[model samples]
Target chain A: MRIFDPHIHMTSRTTDDYEAMHAAGVRAVVEPAFWLGQPRTSPETFYDYFDSLLGWEPYRAAQFGIQHFCTIALNPKEANDPRCLPVLDELPRYLAKDRVVAVGEIGYDSMTKEEDEVLARQLQLAVEHGLPALVHTPHRDKAAGTRRTLDVVRESGIAPELVVLDHLNELTVGMVLDSGCWAGFSVYPKTKMSEDRMVRILREHGLDRVMVNSAADWGSSDPLKTRKTGLAMLADGFTADDVDRVLWRNPVAFYDQSGRLDLDDTDGEPKPDDTSSFEGNSIRRGGE
Target chain B: MPNSGTAPHPSLPLTPEARAWLDTALTEIATAPTTIRTLFPAVRRHCGRAPLPDGRTVDEAVRALLLAALPLRDQALTDEVGALHRYGDPAEQRAVLRALPRLDPEGTGRFLDLVRQTLRGNDNTLIEAALGPYAAAHLPADEYRQAVLKCVFCEIPLARVAGLDDRADAELARMLGDFASERTAAGRPVPEDIAPFLHPFTTSGTTTSGTTIHGTE
Candidate 1:
């Protein structure tokens, strides 16, 4: 079955991950610009990162037959820093880039006033650009963050359907779903929801606008977390159709809203003699 | 010592100042040998090869190399200093500082200064650089073996070399062959983790059944 991981950090993953995901039938991925594990010090760094997302990463993904897409935003954690203003000013240029599916990985981290202001401005930009926003719910004080996120999206006058409240657990899923915005569950290792819990939520929520992602990045997280979640759903007797809708259809529908979800026709069926190396143009020396 | 651009001879006694600088430079070189080695090729590539003034030994060449390489290294280090400050560990910062000579002071001090400033305020990048050696030094034998195995399977660059022992590669090949045989017998989707490493001979075509045949020896 074809699958689409709505959230993943292909930059932090190895080429082996791309091949594995392809082997497991993942046809596409949406990578939202989030803070690298280390804080970035300048707008230049952010611009370079955005360039890689649009340029080099897509080329790398193509080597493994996976379509790569991205979302642009000033992540909440970085918004707290004063030096990040220039980055915020530069967000519009990236928003205009091709294959930017949403303005996101944006939302409250501490529910601070700084976060609120930045989120408000970005939500406005999303409205002006006529694009959807991928909202990242705060890891701490999540209920308050979710509540404030929904409030801002409504106050900003963007359609609720245009927002995706990501990383929802049982505690906050109800408010997100009840408010009519899409709920995203990040099936991660240790910190986020596990596969079993994700399936439980899927069973209860019935997979309307719900989606699952690995949200893997430069940390102790698994890139294959979404596949494990899919396997869990299958083990629980969720039909292939139910699995396909959540893992594939919902993400495609969300990203396609920006009008850039076309996969190369060569990708639909496997091509013979596609023996390309996974390292596409990087000069990193192989280890001894 | 008047007009000699050559480094002090290893056999000849060094002045106290030169001795102190050499000691400090050697310490830094020992800790990050690979980084030093990697830089040597770049420096030589850029600076061109020339024999040292008469009577300089290999040890002196190393010291001279560090002196000549310091400027370029310093520039690269400065560019990454902010990233290091944001992400590096404290011990790594201290080690880097210790390795550099004081470039402002005469002799050893000048070299130390250059090294210090090059690495100064860049602890996070240093820590990441130091991790390979640190992991190689600290990881238990079995864990290191497993990490190397995973790195080989995933194509990640690791400190330890794989395929060093002919027997080891052969044993791994046999185990992989057996696993492929089992998958063929059972008709299961090949595990995603191992699928990348399976050569075309083991898994030839796009068809599900075809994957098993390519992995088989």
Candidate 2:
């Protein structure tokens, strides 16, 4: 039951979450740059946070036996913040780094005019960097927001295959699939798609480019949903092969389009012993 | 065998010969994870204590091979190194420490603590390896200052201390002044390497005598 969650916020989660993730057979994750809970006062804050996504977070994840990759972006929620607008200008430096897999979490939040402009620009950044884009549909008025989000993505001039529309639901998945871009369903607890609902979607949609993630983060979410979805797929009469295609292969095929999803699990280095540190700074804290 | 002159930069581009050794090692390590231990005698034959595992030295080959662990998917490399550090003999312990330059970005505090521990012992070979570029680049300031004094206490030449010249500070000068006093009190000659760093903090003695507190004009 190896899993590659294409959308998760590991920076916001704890090391214990990483342990639980590994215990549930999650091998690797893509932590997309999203809005922090608090408003950032300056772009320097984003720079430091981005550096952690690139450096410290990866180091921390490795200690837990998970290979961590990230998506760099100006998240749609913060797009409305004029103070954070400069982060879009500084996006290129972070995008050039080795671990970045996409220009992402980039799409409509409140579906504002400011959100629209930010989406178009970051999509262009995706094309310029030759990386994929991960689009986040607004939870409020999602049906409408997802529709407007698709229009902006269409106009970005980046190939449709190079984008992944995330936080998708039953109403929006069909249109996103029709657009030829990847569709991501977050099998979260309470609000988003649950495991049973996700299994039904896999049965109906037939698993070509569909992927499932926990999208776990600072919000009320579950990191184990990817695995729970896999279990549901099995209970719903999907074969092991079907589960593999959905949980692992689907995300790989999508992110592999970037030509940078170098997951070392199959590439065959020994597992990392992240229990070490640089100077005195360490990801290897005592206990679980 | 430590390259006391100039520690090899961790990112030193591998040459053709070194590349070949690493290739052979990576392939072999895939099957035998502990082949790193089997490599030391070969290094002794080709290059005694040289950190660059290259050409015919089995040690470098082993080192180059173990580096493959650095990129592993899980905690295997950390566990493997941890296992070696826990059970390995002094030479094996030194080999793991020596490999830190190439294998860094490693997150365990144990490795740094191990390097600090080596400085307190009488083994110059281990101390020299521990003092290489990784220590220079990563050892925290307080630990690094104490590490220098450890070298002086052990009579290990400060020449082998990587980053000694670059990271030296006034605090280190003061610490060295106290170390010099400790040596003089014990009637052991203070190694002259103390002179370069000691001069900054030492002041003249009172009474207008021709003598100075640091014992220099």
Candidate 3:
């Protein structure tokens, strides 16, 4: 099963995660610009982070055979920070770049007035840039947050089809799907929806505009949750075609709205003889 | 071929339009440090994507222009150049590396860290940029030899490395010999690019003092 994990934080991940993800058939990923655990003191740091998403991170992923693309935004959690507000101004140039696919991870953390302004502005930027927006519903009060998120997305005047309301559950899924927006599920080992639940959601919703990702990051999460979800669907008697559509094609169709998703042939194995290093560091150890 | 280092900013072989755009950009960047942030990426979009006479992109040429046009020197030059590199993406970083030979013509080691950083990374383009005239002149003998061997390992053409013919020493040759033997033992053919470096040649008695690699060589 060729999988395209629509959301995964590879920056926080090790090379082993990439290897295992590849072994599990994950060929591509979209790393949204989310807040790190430590709060950033300034906007310049976000540029460096954005630059890595555009430059070093993609290069690193290529070494492991995954094509990496990213969404650029002042994440919901950071929107409340005054120092990070300037990132919105620089979004235009970053949005113009080839690899940037969407204005993302943009929505309410606490559903603050500050988050409201940032989300509206970024959603407008997405519309102006003719790109999609990855709207993250607040983990706390998700049903209400998803409702507010849908309201904000509607008011921004962006086509609902171009918006993906992510980190969803049964409570929020109905509203997102009813609103004509894409519904994104982050299948996790704990806390978020599990593989069995995801299989049940698919069983209920029938996978029209659904995308399942591990949303793996620095937290205790499995990058192979998408694959696990696929297995659950198969065990529940879904066809191979059904699994492929949910795992691969759904993401391709959603992000393809950006007109920037490039799924070129990626060489997924580490070449045995290749001794190239990044920033002077190599994946090689004593004798390979 | 002897290690004849690159001539500093040999008259750019640019079309009238490209030269005009570069001149305007240099003026803007000189007046405001902030201008480079936008103009640096705009170089390819404005100056055209065609390869320059030195095999650098038009964007790389602007890097040399910025380094040359700025009035800062010594520690100021070092700090400005370092910041320019620190904030840049790989292509921009590659541009800075390509421009370094001309910016610090004397192998004063001001930019040695930048070159070494590129050499450490696995990006073949950045590695190739690291092997430019600046690195060729500044990289220590031991590290230089390892970088060339790394080029062989990564399949980056040995020809991309500057000053190889002049800098190729007995140690590098021995390392390549062992590498070739290993490939043979593994039933793999050796890389063809190493042939020119492996052949025996006497170095001129005059030591190569300069740090630069002329693309023409």
Q: TM-score winner among the candidates?
A: 3
B1-217: candidate 3 lDDT, tens digit per residue: 1112233334666667777777676666566655666566556545554566656665566566766666566787788778767766676678788878667766577988998877776667678878877777767778888999998887777877898877887667778988999999999879888987664634444334444532221
Root-mean-square deviation of candidate 1: 19.4
Candidate 2 local Cα displacement, residue A287, angstroms: 8.3
Per-residue alpha-carbon lDDT of model 1 for A22-124, expressed as tens digits? 8888878999999998998877788768766765576567656788889989899999988876887767656754467799889988888999999999998
Model 3 stretches astray by more than 4 angstroms: A266-281, A284-288, B1-88, B91-122, B133-159, B168-206, B209-217
DockQ of candidate 3 against the true complex? 0.16
DockQ pick, better of 2 and 3? 3
Please give the distance, in angstroms, between residue B71's alpha carbon in candidate 3 and its true position after superposition: 17
Write model 2 residue lDDT over B1-217, tens digit each, in one string: 2122232333434555654555555555555666744443233322233344342233433444455444343356667666555434344555678776556554334356667666655444456668876777667777778888877665557887887776676778888988889869989677788799876544533122111112112
Off by over 4 Å in 1: A266-288, B1-217
- Every candidate's CA RMSD: 19.4, 14.8, 7.3
CA-lDDT, candidates in order: 0.62, 0.72, 0.80
Best by lDDT: 3
Give me the candidate number with maximum DockQ.
3
TM-score of every prediction relative to native: 0.55, 0.62, 0.73
lDDT digits (tens) for residues A111-166 of candidate 2: 88999899999999899889999999889999998888888888889899998899
Residue lDDT tens for model 3, A1-288:
999999999999988888888888888899999999889989899998998898777777766667889998999999998988888887876786657889998999999999999999999999998999999889999999889999999999999999999999988899999999999999888887999988888889888999999999999999999999999999999999999999999999999988778567655464321224432334422112
Q: What is the TM-score of chain B alone in each candidate?
A: 0.22, 0.64, 0.79
